[model samples]
Target chain A: MALELLKERWSSAINVLKVGAVKEEGGTRASAITVGGQTTLPFLLDEGGMPHRPVVAMEIFDVAPLEWPVSLLEPFGDAVKDPVKWAKKCINEFKADLICLTLKGTHPEAENISADKAVELVKNMLKEISTPLIIIGSGDKEKDNDVLARCSQATKGENCLFGLAAQDNFKTLVASCMADDHCIIADSPIDINIAKQVNILITDMGFKPEKIAMHPSTAALGYGMEYVYSIMERSRLAAFVGDKMLAMPFIIFVGQEAWKVKEAAANVADEPGWGDERMRGPLWEAATAVAMLHAGADILVMRHPEAVATVKRSIDSMMKGNND
Target chain B: MLVIGELINGMYQNVEQAIKTKNRSIIHKLAKEQLEAGADMLDINAGPHGADPKETMRWLIETIREVTPAPLAIDSTKLDVVELGLKLAGEGSMINSTKADDEKLDIYVPLAKKYKAKLIGLTMDKKGVPRDKNVKCELAAKILAKCMEMDLPLEDVYIDPIVLPVNVAQAQCAELLDVLREFKLISDPPPQTVVGLSNVSQGTKQRSLINRTYLVMAVASGLSGAIVDPLDKELMDAMITAELLLNKNIYCDSYIDAYRKR
Candidate 1:
């Protein structure tokens, strides 16, 4: 029997952001990633059509030391000491589709690496890995811009994700990425209006929509993650249901957040029979990533090799379902 | 503007009777007429109306999906009901609601992900209905934050700032318009701003007139879509006029054709 169909319409569509650089002559990486290509809401392939499935990118830090949950830190114990080695482990062992390098040491209190040091770390990661890279600053707006500026210049042609373009200080960050012709993370402080506003700001700066990835922000599972999930789902639905302006592919900072929560960080000793922190932590991250995937997250920034593998397997299964 | 026909809800006595009888014909007729009248989607709401809402919602969504392609808006405050409805419906569906409240967000958002459906977010949180438009905006921001966390694309969200009764508060319409405008200004990929469209007409004389007038104003204030009676020619006409005035629809060569044909 033929299933009757319902026509869906939109109030306003959310813009979709593309993930990678195309097989262009511009970036230094072998290729770029693209997400958020929807003519209809996410997963409405039969109703309208989905041009791209969300992608998964692994997370790597420039100077990995201190503050990482032990579960994540233990897996790559020695590799955690070396950025290049860690990047290799992520791609080779973890099968990461892409690598996101967070310049944590560039902050005021951390190692406080100079702009040149930041660039060197990024350059090292790029040399060590073939997948596309996403470069983020350590949350310090000024320091972020400085390091991102140099990193963007240094990784010119690689199409890396430069410093997150926050509302207040996106000017320098955006400028740096533009100068080196790199992709950027249009980061917002968990507000849909601000996310759209930032996109408008970035586009107004003449940056292409396809070149930007909006991290609307992610919340760990068991910690308001569902709220984040719903908002992202709604945004994607509006865009695909018929709001072309917001139809850009979206990315999620899953690992950074998922790992921060007690469910993913604390041990059984701390929580009492919550199971092994080693397995539980990665599962928490994987579960969070998987849930977000269904909600239309195009790029997932994850940590822990096992979590990455688990998410990849799930994506493979989902794609198979989509294909059938 | 997309009008999601506001029928098939258990809140309405007729729909409740129809559901109890398992009257496929009544449900089919309701579905067919609304689709013909240009309802982009049919909102299948089976709220707790003194029966098993979950069971009733499941049946309604299944029965409705069997008849129409205008994707189902799984309307219910119950998670089990929404989950059942979403599973029973086809792709590209929308969950009728989750509110701005953190607890509500926690429940409804997971269901959205589980079902992979778009959702209608009510601006009223645990704090009750906010009288201030800025507060509504803040509520919307919180809702949007949840969307990001979920990785559900912002475009899939349809924000419905809780519409107060105009009879109770004459300035409600103006306040709603301000909230809707602020809603339009959210994120790079902003969620769709929608309203119940008839809530303001409650207790008013000449309901159709009041409803249509309020709808036009709402649309003018950046309301991209609404849940309304597509059967009402006046209401539909207001939509066309609103879209044209908003410049969302082109009037260049098809002005007469569009107006007369409608």
Candidate 2:
């Protein structure tokens, strides 16, 4: 009866695809990440149903990232210099459910690293971090295809999420995902049409539909955040009804994009009387992540240990079964 | 002004039976009721009911066409069902689903072009339903791409992201409004945003009340057409109110006229 009631209340519990085959089931990875499967938007316990708590992935960089604003520097001081150390700090200190390692340095311009160099870093990341890992590109389309393809093979049995499958190059990423039996981040710009187009393109390649964790694009709060939030929310709605094709779980790069902006990372005198940069920055990231969660973001690729902690607490509290 | 009469669907068992029996009497009655209730087109769905969907669809379409000149909305998941129904519809028919899936378009675009029929594209693709509004729009664009590729006119592409249930998916309503706003801005001629309004109230109490309220909001958010029952008085009233609020009707005057006619 409770199950029936839950089903009735949550008319459309969005289907969350569970990626990776466990050794218990067939593959590696100690456990798997379950995204989607939400009956309501974030934190509406009384009205709708909540399924699979939102998963938080702490961001790790391939190389010591130079562009991280100084305000964010203090938290990961020495760890920033070492990718494995950064993943350790993210898992142990930050208590991240998953770790997202951005292959930002693999960009032809970022670090100009070879595919072997990229593979070595991923090998170290997989060895160092026990949590599920998501490997992202350096935001360069062509470089990502070549590098992520190599990373996919390097992390073959790990069920990692290769951090992008764009509309133009999803075919290559899909092939890599198929070969590696891994998941992909179906990332698109802020347009809903582009996001769906990418997903359609990926599936059209004969890849497993559940393996695609669509990134509907995230915008920092002050800078067109509402637009991004609204788009994510609408995509969730389309999934529930009779539309079978669009029912996949969604991924949001909650921390990386939302936190890097000046509004989120700016310190004292930077924005004049804008409080403590430390508190303000994580809060901005958390707020953005929370808003996207409400907009039906299943997986949040976040940064900032404190922000990750806060967002996890919120998810836990929101998911405490509305039967109360 | 393009009111797609979403009556006569298999979701309701009576209609399902009527379609199965090829009961011209019941089918004819429903069609005339919708026409009288100001429906511009009548949507016919045999759905997943335990009936020969194709035959039921053909029967429903043929019977409705014989009774009223209202254009047909060939509603079905099966591409062939839509194709067969379109062939049966003769002219000025509307295909109910061309999903964001390119495979669907592989079938729908050609059928639509061949029949010169208007097509409704469900804003979902091969990966299935998207939970984000942007993805829905992206799906719409993908479907539009297939339409454009086939030289199908943009005006004939009616996009339905398929409205989310509000009580269950609370943020869904707000998200849909956002999608509607973006859809208005991004679409070339802006393929019309149609919705199955009844689904919004599927599991809720005072469903008519919820559906009517949402209908007002949806229409205001540039919903060009809706797959809604023309028979529900409350829904009809909400549509009139929405038209007035949007000034699609010049004042409350049209509302009064519509109400009086009813």
Candidate 3:
């Protein structure tokens, strides 16, 4: 008969997945980052436990340059040419929680670089940075299958997070991650069914479900970002209520989606309605990353340091009452 | 869970008024709400409203069909009323009930076969519900046998062990689980099991708690369908969690959301 007495009893808790490795664990990272062990919705420590905070991973391209919008490139400066330095700068300067080494050059159409080149870059970045590593392959399906597999093997014992595996191209990457004791990023189109099916398929391949991270294809804020938000939200809700298949930590390509959108890079001169170009781009990225985080993104792959700092502060302060 | 939404019945003021006034909008609105809340089927009952039961069934069917062609469970003790609703309903339907009496099964089985409608056979016979699990199972097998003899596929038969109000029949609660499990062994292609879930908490203070707890336990006992209120958020949440624990559904973080989307 009373409102306060109406407390609900949630039956199942989300399964937690720990990514990254440390020295004792046979890797060089400063610490392991664990996510997805929430007993309630994000930061609802009132309802249940949120074992891990949303982590921010500063993305560094292996090849760099050529295509980054000036607003984005302005922050990194000379570090653009070398990945090892770029990754180191993200950790040492921005205090990035993790380093996501994007093997952009390995895409067949981009530089047509060989898998050997990507492996070398991964090794160098791992050596240069103390933060946990998350390696992302270029979007090309066939090329990513080869590049991610080889890179996964090259850093075999590091317990890194490596993937971007689609429904058709997951086997090689899944096998590599399974064999190497690394985590996976099971990427699906912006659809729940496909996202769930992909996770099932990856697990069906004998890979443990907890070692997977979801990349339910997202879009930037102005460019249909709500679809990504809903998909991720749904995935998390399912996980909280006891769906182990979709219970993996979510890894959103915030930087990738945010930077590619026209609004993030559009110049004020081109569209006078948009105020300053410098502030617009980073703010756009920050806004998108923040949205993804609240929508149950466990790890964010972000670009701008200012945006990274903003999102990190947002994550830190968001869990204020939870006693994280 | 085959949620047969308990709305769209004349028992509620809105639906009673809708049935009396033939207000298609109100019936359609409830139908949509139930479906949105993840009901697999809608139960069309011309509850205590002031109208001819047959005409009320026809009107309810027309109102529901106007918006969506969702499956319906024609709920009424009157066989003719259920038959009329089943005839007017656009798609598949489940006859809300028939007791395990041979006379009732003889009539209901032929009607079910002729209309291709599924039947919900209660495990209570002329003597009323027996508290014993074997007694309940025997009645269920009697109904299952009649359906088999009539060549009505066993899959189309859903056996309800007739849940008793826990406040009075608390002793029957444990036997309910035993009866459900034994029903699976009654026939090959095993008749699906169902329950009028809310009946378990008929006069109980913790109605929602009792309904969901009993539903989850019944699910563990292989209950395939339940006549439940789709709008009961906590009840639905508990059922979703139960399926996940049973490993019937692949686990997802947003399981309730994903289940709702489905």
Candidate 4:
């Protein structure tokens, strides 16, 4: 008797989203990246098609970090002090596919920079690095509305991806992205229904579905990571089963979530049983990224040079259909 | 669940008056309201309204198509009326039904295939509705076999295991649910299952309550579609909750709102 492989066919495919546009297409990036468009579940090529491999976006802040551990701050050296140097080092040395510029300095409790200052930093970052940018606002909702609108206008035609548009605060981001020809990140708090609802609300505001990405908020390893993993799995399954509202590509913040956990951030002397802090931290981040990739993450906003290399290699191997 | 809005049928007095006067506004309003309430398809029936059934069907379809392109179920007992509606409504329409008999299948099966329309097969013959669950399954198997022999894709076939009013045939209600469960076993990729949901509550005082409770139970028994009044908010909410509980949809606090939007 011959072996008969059972294959499940899906009725729909995930929508493909382009992150950036090159100069000929009215953007200054050297090249653009396309993600999503998977006809099957992640890395299961025997059943269907996964046309594009998942890409990594390295995270940078507009202002220097005051809380990063020694293991994390050591890799960037003095580049951490300057956003342009940090972005260039990420693209030139670490080969990051994208740069996620978080405007944390604009928060009221932080440096409390004005929208003008945020726009200046964005302009400087765009001038230095030809890589695509993912610009996000500070956590302050009222301040983000003002700062992101200014930044979005300053980066018109660049087609950068903007972030953190939740259910309650998506109108401003939607209008900005609509006017600027950029993509948006629709965030939900680990609930698949809210995830879909946020997408619906954004689309209702006339933002094109192809220009939207879903951010089901991330969780680190051993700290409710499975919740996020399962949510992404269920979401991808829903998209494959022809739920148009949930059919957008997923963009997860692996570095931001993973690095905040004690397993990845605690000092080695504090927990002797857990190996060295340097190796343990990067491995924790790398494991989280790989797990998310398997759960159908199309774009991972990651940090740590070593973790980025590991995840990139893993994506290459997975795309090659290697089972070993 | 594939909710087929049951408001456009001439059996309703309002629809009968609309069909009699050729009132496009009345029919158009019903179509829009049902769709807005989340009907995946519309069921158009020209009941005994003393008008030319073919003309009434054509007028209903044309009026509704002007408002929206939602799929229509060309519902009628007359073969000529069904054939005319099928021709005018174009592809993606459904034959509201045919009895599980060779004579009826021979005509409806070919017409459905030629028109690229779905065919709904009721599990009953000229002898009348089956009293036992096994007999209903036997009739369903006959319908499935006929569809297979005639080269129609089973995916386009919906097996309706005839629901009777609880006031008249109370014993058959449970049996019909069993038949729905058994219908899946008759084929590899089972044919879709549907029910005329309002039939179960005829002459009942608590019509909405009965209809919704029975709908949830039928959904649990693998009912894939229902012909119901989508405007009934409570009934539609029950259907949405049942699907969510079955893991057919992901849960959020505002799932009812989400389903209506979808």
Best by lDDT: 4
Highest TM-score scorer:
4
Task: Order the numbered candidates by TM-score, best leading.
Answer: 4, 3, 1, 2
Estimate the overall C-alpha local distance difference test score of candidate 1.
Answer: 0.76
DockQ of 1: 0.02
Give the range where candidate 2 chain A is weakest over 10 consecutive residues by summed lDDT.
Answer: A3-12
Residue-wise C-alpha lDDT for candidate 4, range B171-198, written one tens digit per residue: 9898888888888899988779999999
Q: lDDT tens string, model 4, A1-324?
A: 999999988989999999888989898999888999999999999989999889999999989986998898899999999999999999999999999999999999999999999999999888888988999999899999999999999999999999889999999988999999999999999988899889888887889989999999999888888999999998889888867788899999999999999999888899999989999999999999999999899999998999999999999999999945
Ranking by lDDT: 4, 3, 2, 1
Q: Model 1 over residues B171-227: C-alpha lDDT tens digits? A: 878888877777767776566888887788788887899889888888888786799
Give TM per candidate. Answer: 0.56, 0.56, 0.60, 0.88
How far out, in Å, is residue B133 in model 3? 19
For all candidates in order, the CA lDDT equals 0.76, 0.77, 0.84, 0.92
Model 1 alpha-carbon miss at residue B78, Å: 57
Off by over 4 Å in 3: A1-8, A322-324, B1-262
Separately for all candidates shown, the number of backbone clashes (residues 3 or more apart, or on different chains) is 74, 25, 18, 0
Task: Specify the CAPRI tier of model 2.
Answer: incorrect
Candidate 4, residue B28: how far the Cα is off, in Å: 3.8
Q: Score the docking of each candidate (DockQ).
A: 0.02, 0.02, 0.06, 0.37
**lDDT per residue (tens digit) for residues A1-324 in model 3:** 666744444656666778788888888878888887777777766777787788888888888765888989988999989888888889889888888888888877889889988888788878877777998888898888888888888888789998787877788888999999999888888987778878877877889878888888879998999988887777677666555667778888889889898888988889899888799999999999988877888888899999998888888788785323
Question: What TM-scores result for chain A when each predicted structure is judged separately against the true chain A?
Answer: 0.91, 0.91, 0.94, 0.99
